[model samples]
Each structure stands twice: as structure tokens, then as C-alpha cells.
Target: MIAAIALAFSFLTATAQAKVLELHRGVGVHEWLNWSPVNEDGTYIWPPYRAEQEWLDSFRKGTVSKGENEFQRIRSMGFDFVRLSVDPGPLVSSEGTKRKEALAILSKAVKRITASGLRVVFDLHGVNQVPATSMKLIYDGADSEGVARYRAMVKEVAGMLVKVGTDKVAIEPYNEPAYYPCDASGTDDWQRIMEATVADIRSVSGDLTIIATGACGGGVKGLLNLKPGFDDPNIYYSFHMYEPHDFTHQRSETKGGFASGMPWPASTSTPEAVRKALEARIDAAGLSRAEKRANLAEADPLIAKYFAENWGEKQLDARFEQALGWAKTNAIPSERLFMGEFGAILMTADGRMGADDADRIRYLTAVRRSAEKAGIPWSIWEYANTYGMSVIVPKENAVPDMNMLGALGLMRQ
Candidate 1:
């Protein structure tokens, strides 16, 4: 009788512990898992990797070969999840051979990541970006040919998920899907395509969690307008937070020309400094006084729009509140809301820290803490890099940016 009771107790304990885990705190592991490496020639490579076969084999064995213990390091930082961003183009091909090879590589990665005890959000990122090939299905999946191709990709991926099992995995249909205006029409179009994609995935695996997002590069406003067709319990809505792009992406060539040396709080001094910088730039361009004034007029609003405005904790709070309000209005629970990406660029256009460590820390702590307090799960944009907002500083001996980690509360000391 005693032995039977003990066995029953053990069984019950195991059952109780097998709860569905939600991704709360996480960091994006990034483009490594995404298959988009280009060859030296202008032509794109097939497997999307530029590395040698031996190194690629090691990656399958859970060794990144990039001289870092990725899984162990992420766990040590108290992050519960890693959003593996995957590029779908290279994974799906007209010929079965290339597609199968890519899937095998991805399968190895998913297995290695899951075995490390970290939850994985397998994000189908960058499908919307115009690829070298003539596939526009990601943008026009609502159409006939587009929908057919998109559905096929999802179907194949869902089958793979069945093999990986949905224990610690979730699928994000697309990343940063953008359409103009973000109005009712755009939202409806996105909804139609997303519904189709979800249906396609469900046809293969009904138990897998599906993450949905809106258009406008998956911004907050876009997410606000996204409404899932069915009230499925396993669906999550994700938004990327990089508001006041001038403030966040300043000095990055990606956003525009270099916009560096901007402050967080946007004091009177901040704008004056910006104005002076603008004037100096205009002067160097050999513009006359009238031309310079015109240039300043043209540039002033942008500076004010991004930085001169009040952008303290209150601003950040209000931004988040808008999302929370939308969620409440839609009857969506907070647990179903997620901020999938948020981070600041550390490097300036000239390749230096844009803001002082103190200012950057203050800004990071405010945004991250605010999101957490709102009961929303969040992930930093990246883990390791020298030029971006990465917590790990790259070197021969990689080192953690303690200040950045401290700001995110990942480091106490």
C-alpha cells in the first residue's frame, strides 16, 4: 500500500509540473538561425550559409563554432526564452532537394535549442523583404498564387513542428509585415492572409501555438488593429517597440543619414545642440544663409519629432498604455500580449557609443521595466554584436556589457 501511494504521488507531481510555459522574458538570438548569408559573388547562395561544411556540421551538433556557448550563456542571464528568427526563402524551394536540405539544418537547430531547456519562438522573419527570387507571396499572400505558395510553406513548417513537437516551440507567421496607412482596409487584408496562414498551419498541427502580428513593420499601432479570426486560446499578438525612430535609430544608416549625439530626455540644451550641429552641417555644405535657414527649417521638425519632444518615462508609459488599452478593449488578456523586440543602438554613425552609458542605461531600464510592470513579456533586440544594442561586446575574448545588462536588470552588480 505504501509503495502504491508513493508511485501515485510521483505521477501526480509530474502531471502538475507539465504546464504550458509562456515566454515572458527573452532575447532575440538573431540572424544566425535565419538563413540569409550572401556569397562573395552578387548571386545568392542556396543553403544561405557562407561557412564551410565542417563548421556547419558542428552547428548542427549544438556548437555555434562562433566561439561562444550560446544556450548556456542565455540561461545564465536569467532569460527564459530565445526568439530564433528564421528566413523562410531558403527553406522553401521549387526543387525538393534544396528545401529538404534546409529543413534538415533547421531541424537540427530546433532540437539543439530545445534540448538546452530554453523555450523557442520560431519566427518566420524577413519573408516580406523582396528576395532575389520573384516571390512576393509574403506581401500578397491574399492573392491566388501567393496564398498557394505561402500555405505550402506553412504546411511544410507545421509538419516539421510535429516532428520537433510543440512542447517548447511556437511559430510567428511573419515578422514586420508592413502596409501603408494601417487603416481598416490594411488591417483586414493582413487579417485575411494571417487567417489563411493559421488555417494552413492548423491543418498539419493543431496543438502548436501561433503568434500573430499586424502590419506597419509590426509596430504598436499596427498590432492594435490586428484581430484574430477565431478566439483560439493558443494565439499570441506580438509588437516590436522602436518608437520615436529618430531617438532609437539615430546615427544608423538604415533609418536615413547619420543622426547622432541626441539625448534621451530632450532638454532645451538638447535641441540647441542639435540646431548647432545642423547649422554646422549646412555651413560645411557651402549653403548661403538663406539656404541654411531653409535647410534648418526642413530639419527642425524631424529633430523635434524624434528627440526634442518630451520622451521620458511618462512618454514610454503612455506608449505602452495605448497597447494595454487596445488589448482591454478587445477583451484580450495581458498574458496574450507580447513585445517581441525592443532595444537601442549603441553605436553612432561614426562608430562610437551614441549616448553615454548612463543615459543609455536610464532609457533601457525605463522601457524594459515599464513593459514588465504591464504584465507583458518582452525580448531585447539582440545578444552579441559590437555596433548594435547588444548586451555582449564582441572581442577575441567576448565580454558582457555590464552596464547594458545592469539596465535590463540582468546584472545586479
Candidate 2:
């Protein structure tokens, strides 16, 4: 009798543990992830390439590894998710041989990631024969025909994922929608595109999560104003947060030209500065007095739109709150809101090569903490080179400040 009781207890304990593990194993309904490319040489190549012949040849020849090693390093750094870029053209080929090859590569990657206990987000980074500028389907006079072509391509990709039973894989319709231009009229057209794309994906697999990029890549205001389609729980909103691009793309030695030694946009540090800058620009443009006054009033509310009074040491906390409020107002649950891209570029006061590691840590730490507080998921801008957080081919061998990671409560040690 005693032996039997002990055996029963052990079996129940094991079953309970298994259930707990299973709950955590699948792609999370709400969680954070990091984005990066898987280069052939296992190192993430910085500054993602457009579909140029020279770039393609170099990438294929292993001259540019999209940082596979860096991805592993990111995993080691404690990230449980990854967003991989798939050039839609290559993945969806008219030639059966090319399509098979692409599928094989993707399948291998999915298996590898699953084995490593990570979830995957497949981003249709670029479409074939289409330049990056015109890749998105949302812009005015956008190749409507091209948009249809890419929609078909996405359906094909979604079909493959469904067939493979890879539930962890989600699809991002396009990488960055606002890299081109989309006015109010274009925005309406893009909504139709989004509705169509979502329907196509659902036709293949209703379970797949469809990530839609917002205007200006889902800016907070745009997201709040959006009225998503009817009863699509599988859809989510994504927005890139590389605000004040002038700071993020400061001059570098290798990529010469443009302004050299320009400082990070001062406006980002405070809302008042941002408002003042906007006012000055409107005034300088020589708008009619009435127009200028209207513009100023219109912009005034935006200054305090997403801020908190007691933001404290966490400045990003206010920003996150503002963004979350926008999402909530739009009927988007916290789970559906994500910080799709955000990272600080390292730049010296004199505009030199090495970045300010301390500042980078502070910025990232604030953002991470804010996301946790807001109950919103987030992904770092990148896992490697371009933004200076290259884990595999770091710009310098300097040891990471473990304390900084700890400050963000990311590193246990």
C-alpha cells in the first residue's frame, strides 16, 4: 500500500511539472523578442541591404553573414524570441527549384530555433524586383499590382508555415511602411490592403498572428486613430520608435557625406523643446498667421499627450504610458501593442567611431523597464552592428557593463 501511494504521488508531480513547462514552451501570447538577420557566416551584417545584385552576390558568397552567431549570442544574452528577415522575392519564386530551396532553408531555421527553445517571427522585409522605397503596399501611387503580387506571396508563405505545423511563427506584412510616403488618401487604400492581407492569411491558417505596420511604421498617434477590421483577434499593431532619425543616423567614417559632427536631436530630451522646434518651423515656413496659430494649437496637445507627471528616473516610463494610452483608446489590448524597433546609436560628442556604451545602456534600460511597467511587449532595434549592439562582431572588445544589465533587471547576476 505504501509503495503504491508513493508511486501515485510521483506520477502526479511529474504530470504537473510537465503541464507547467508546456504552458511556457509555446510562443507567448504577450512577450518581448529581439530582431536580427541570420547571415551565412553566422554574424549579423549591419545596415540591412536592399535587393541589389551586388549585395545579393556578396551575401550568398558568405561575405556578409547576417549574424547567425550574433543571434546565438543574443539567445545567450537571455532573449527568448527572434524576428528574421525573409526577402519575399526569394522566398516566393516562380521557379519551383528556387521556392523549394527557400522553403528548405526556412524549415531548417524554424527547426533550429524551436530546438533552441525560441519563437520565430518571419518578417517580409522586402519584395522581389521592388526597391526598399516602394516595398510597402500603403503608399500613394504604390504599385497596386505589386501589392497584389506580394499579397499572393504572403499567402504562399503562410500556407507553408501552416503545413509545417509551426504555430510559433507569426507574419509581419511588411517591415517598415512609412519609409516611403502615405498621405490620408493613401492611408485609406492601405487599410484595404491590410484587410485583404489579413483575410488571405486567415484563409490558410486562422491561428497565425498577423502583424500590421501603422502609419509612419505605426506611430503612437496613428495607432490610436486606427479602426482595425471586424473581430480579428489574431491581428496586432507594430510601430518602429526611431524618433528623431537625425540622431540615429549621425555621420560615420565608412559611410561618409551627410552632416558630420551633428549632435543627437536635443528635442528628444524634453517635450517643451519638441514643441518649440515645431512652432519655429511653422513660423519660418511663412504660413498665414491664422494657419500658424492653428498649427501651434494643434501641436500643443501632442507635447503632453503621452507623458506622466511622476515619471521619476524613468523618463521612458512616461513615453510608454503615453503610447499605451493611445493603444488602449484604440481598443488594442496591451498584448497587441509592441515596441517593434528601438535602440540608441553610440556617438561621441565629437562624432567619433565608438559609441557611448553607458548612454546606450541607460536608454535601453529605461525603455525595457517602461515596457515591463506598461505591460507592453518590445523588441530591441537590433541584435547586431547597425545600432552598435552587435553581439558577435562588436565594434570593440570592451566588456559589457554587467551592472547596466542588472539595472534594467535583465541580468540576474
Candidate 3:
């Protein structure tokens, strides 16, 4: 049955090739989980927060219609796929009544997206946000019981997707595994979690592609100490890049919050600066030096081990080379590797909340050029958001820079 499904999907993909179903050339539409498509009291509610239940109602009602329309707009702009932020917590309500309602809303959204001929990657963004000790039935800690629960969650989601016939759905098990620091040795238990999660999912849906995130959303270094037995064909190693977070998260004086008025040195973006900073931090922290050195020593052949990896081209060029070298030494194929997420901030020299559109374009162009030269596929950081390549203003106005998106290969024309 699994073979048959794979064959059918393969055929569908092949036939759809003329439509340019380029997975590597995709862009993410971040904050989909909090986004709503409805207006309240003459104001549009975007980035709907959890506390705003009324706004959520309006948003849910509008999302099926509005979400589809937005996706259509994206597709029209020449994008072939979207990375959706999906939280299964809402779908699995504590109360029976709420569970049904949540499922209905999600089903509607999924149906609309699939019908539009666009592939969707269901990212489990906030599993641990729930009150339960065990989220998605996967154990947060190494305890036996937690592991059991985590497995249960994985099986449940896999079974649900199978029933829905959402063949294009790719599961991102956890959003950012390295958000919390691990041991001093830099030993994160991701391999254990991935192994168990993959086993559960494969049990239910034999061929579901699973995208595995690295620790702290960094690159291949996080996966170095992973136990050897966990590798699987269906697994796609994934990572997220929001480099020199100071740059990406910088905000203006008027925008008062965590990101406001933060200063990031311009030198940090340079290759030498990044290498120095990374080396210094690694040395100071007394973490993972031996493993990193060993990996770099054998870097030539390990490049093919990863299915996809994300990084900022300018900020982490040395790290990228190290990773690629390892893959090459390990005899890993280039096609299996990819740059999953990357983009520059739209900022000016003075660090205000405005678009330095040319710099953004240049950054993307350089990344794309480098990836193409390396024979690696890539997905730009975003679409239809301020941080993304395009900005989705309130109401119907989507201020899209066709040239920028075009440069990133997100927009064909």
C-alpha cells in the first residue's frame, strides 16, 4: 500500500512538473497559525494572538475564504509551496465539543490549500505550549512515560493525516529543539525524540516525509552527536536561519518592545566576524569542541547526509563550507541537501523599521547564486509578511516587490 501511494504521488508530481513544483525554490508564510481572515468593527485582525478569542472567531471564519484567496495570490506570484504553522493542540481539545470544532476549522483550511494545487508542510509549531507534561504524546524528557505519550501523539497525527488523504503534507515534528540549552557537552536529545517520533509516524503512514529540525535552529553541527541508528530514508533534515538575530530582530525607537532600538554591529555580517564570534563563543562555553573538530576533520563526505539545511549565506558562509565539506567527504549526494530557510532584514543604515529593499534583494540574490553554484536547492525565509520578501498590509493591500521576489526566484515574471 505504501509503495502504491508513493508511486501515485510520484506520478502526480511528474505530471505536475510543468507547473514548476520546485520544492527547494519555495518560501515560507510565517505566522499562519495566528493569522485570521476576518474584520472586526472595521479593523482587520492579523497575527491574532491567543488571548483574542473573538478575533479568532472572525479570523477562522475568514481564513477558509481569505486564506484560499491569499494562497491563490501567492501561487499567481509564481510560488509553488507554503510552509504552514499548524498547532495540533487546538485540534485535540480537552472538551469533546471544542475538539470537533477545531478539527472542522483545520480540515476546511487544509482542503482549501490542497485544492489550490499548492503543497503544504504542516509545521507543529507549538506542541509544548500546552499544559500537558507530554505533548503530542511524545515525552519531553527521557522518562519512559513521556516517551510513550510522545509516540502516541505522533501516531495520532499520522493516522489523522492518512485519513484526510493529505498526501502533500510533510510533518515538522518540533519547531525549534534547541531553544532551551542542552548539556554542557551540547548533547541535545533530538535523536531520541526523532527516532521515536519517526517510528510512530511510519507505523501509521508508511511514506510520510518527516522534516527534522536541528538544535536551536542552527545548522548541521547540532546533529553531529546524534546516535547512528536513527537515520531513515523518509527523513529530511531541516534547519531555520535568522542570523545575527540582532540584525533580524532589530526594531526602531517608535516600535517599543523586545526588538526596539537594538543596535547590531555592521561588522557581524562579515565572514571573518562571524567566524571569530562563533569560535570565541564555542571556546568560551566549553561546549561541543571535540565533536565539531571531528566532524570538520571528516567534513568532505558528510555533505550528502542532510536532506535540507538552512543558514544565512553572508553571516555563516564558513559554517556552510564546513557542513558542505563534511557532506562531500561522507559521499552524501547534493540533491539530498538544501537551504531550507534564509533571508535578510529589510532595514536601512540607521536601523529603522523600513525596507532597505535593495539590500534585501542583494542578500537573497547572493544566497540563491551560492546555492545554485553549490548544486543545492533553497527556500527563501518568507512571503507575505514584513520579515518575508513581501509585506501583507492590513486589508486587501499586499505590497509585493515583484523585483525582489523575482530575484529570489519566488516570482517567475
Root-mean-square deviation (CA) per prediction: 7.3, 12.2, 12.0
C-alpha-based local distance difference test score of model 2? 0.51
1-413 per-residue lDDT for model 3 (tens digits): 99999986875454333121235556665555533332454222322223323432332433444334666766776666677666545443323455445545655665666677777666665544444421434435544575555456556666655565646666666666552354355534566666777766766655566666556454555533333354454455564544444444444332221111212223224434333433443344454766435433332122211111322454456655655674566454544455677665564323323224554565567666766676665666666554433433222344566667767766544
Question: What does candidate 2's lDDT look like per residue over 352-394, in tens digits?
Answer: 3322455455555666666666656666655434334432223
Q: Which one is best on TM-score?
A: 1
After aligning candidate 2 to the native by TM-score, how far in Å is the CA of 40 from where it should be?
19
Give lDDT per model, in order.
Answer: 0.69, 0.51, 0.51
Q: Rank the candidates by TM-score, best first.
A: 1, 3, 2
Worst 10 residues of 3 by lDDT: 299-308
Candidate whose lDDT is highest: 1
TM-score of each model, paired residue for residue: 0.80, 0.63, 0.64
How many angstroms is residue 173 displaced in model 3 relative to the true structure, after the best TM-score fit? 1.3
Q: Mark the regions of model 2 whose C-alpha exceeds 4 Å error after superposition.
A: 1-73, 92-97, 127-143, 179-186, 244-246, 252-319, 348-350, 353-355, 396-408
lDDT of 2 at 262: 21
